[model samples]
Target: MSTTLSPLIDLQLKGFKVYEKNLTLQEAERPLLAAQIFSRRDYYKVLLLESKCVLHYAHQRLELDGGQYLFFTNPHIPYSLELRTDRLHAYACLFTEEFVAAARSESLHQSPLFRIGSTPLFKLPASQADYVRGIFHKMLAEQQGDYPFKGDLIRTYVQLLIHEALHLQPADPVVQPNNAATRLTSLFLELLERLFPIELPTQQLTLKTPQDFADRLAVHVNHLNKAVKQVTGKPTSAHIAGRILDEAKALLQHTDWSVASIATCLGFEYPTYFNNFFKKHTGVTPLSLRRKD
Candidate 1:
């Protein structure tokens, strides 16, 4: 039987004060609020907002200014932002594995761009940021406008996001070669890319164990932990559990799945155990989050 995994990037914040705020920014000086998601999955979805906000990432943060960019990948690799401006205009678009296939020939699957073992997320510097911004803005305009070939154009812009990101670097730090520890962490990250959607936290159906994950990858548990920690600076269990809770929140907010059923799907042997686990992770009962319509 197929297990149900959690959904990545659950953005429907329940009952937050921000929900009642304005969503458009026509003002000339409105700041930008953006967050780029870097994930373990194959999809990349960037959120471009017109207000100011913090950029959410796996381990770090970016303070967004006017008309900023936020990139995302699947399995919700840690990214989000809290907008500061009064009005927020944002467009979120998703590109799947199709992007890679469309970008390169079959033989180049192993190329550096598509390599599962390297960094998958990159942010544009201020110098080149405007170019990328224009591409994405054109995309948003195309999406909002009624153009005959709007769909095709949107895909083209999405392609540009990836292409441009690969070339853009941070302001103060330049990317360097991967060291032994970095290599190990990169391998674990690659493993997450492969394992995430297949063992989706939302699906609730999965082995749900670090040992099981290590076994599936044919690596020792300690070795895997070392590698994952070295690269990401977070423990393997932290990623796994966080991914699970993310989907749990998504489903709890979006679906009518019974808590017991959701729990079982997430690999808890008993509903009570799942309940406790949920409480421990979220500090609130599952029903509280699910109570909203």
Candidate 2:
């Protein structure tokens, strides 16, 4: 079943928050940890968990039992957690890509923990678990403190957690059926959705074709086409065109960017190409769409 896990918003800052699993719940309230089935969120997450549970992450599954586990998830991938027993204890840190951009680390999305197709779960040794727990404790304290530089301190802790996970070997996922098509389709969609909202005029879409996505996902174009068609009932090119069309309409209606700027941002070599594509898909020019709004 599909579910949406809402973020615990931080009023002081829009993008980052930390949670102690038990403290957030009332005496009569149960944790909603299991409500994350196949859900995607618009932030990055690092979780330190002490529970017996099953994690359905993208196309992979991991069964964790009474061990200290560290999990990393990004906005693009979909994941879920199923508790095997009710005794749950965990600490989670959630932040957006913008929140940690100020850190002196490499791009968080390119990190092994958050990269697509990389393993996200790790089983930590008892001693390492204690060290990881200490970082989370510091994050919790800094999040509530009145220090003006607390955001910077929290970002440093987030980097520490990521660096720690980088040194650990990721846990192996449980073996499953040969559902390559489903797995590839899920990954394709995730990659497609990752380049969205077009927050700035200078921001550009990178993977705009089936071959581009295929190369990024490390699959042949034919295989990607077959898999996307088999799973989504549409060709890979159709999906790409559909998403571009949607973004074109949204940009035209919502922003004051010139048609040429929008065209370049969407990866068109020329505004004429964008014009033809938009009219072909929507039967109206980009300017016409804007005028209607």
What is the alpha-carbon RMSD of candidate 1 to the true structure?
A: 10.6
Return the TM-score for each candidate structure: 0.63, 0.55
Which residue pairs in candidate 2 collide? none
Tell me the tens digit of each residue's lDDT in model 1 across 208-269: 76786788767798987887786777888887777677656655654567888777667778
The most accurate candidate by lDDT is 2
- The C-alpha lDDT values of all candidates are 0.55, 0.77
| lDDT string, candidate 2, 24-65, tens digits | 223213323422321224568899988787886654578998
Model 1 clash count equals: 25
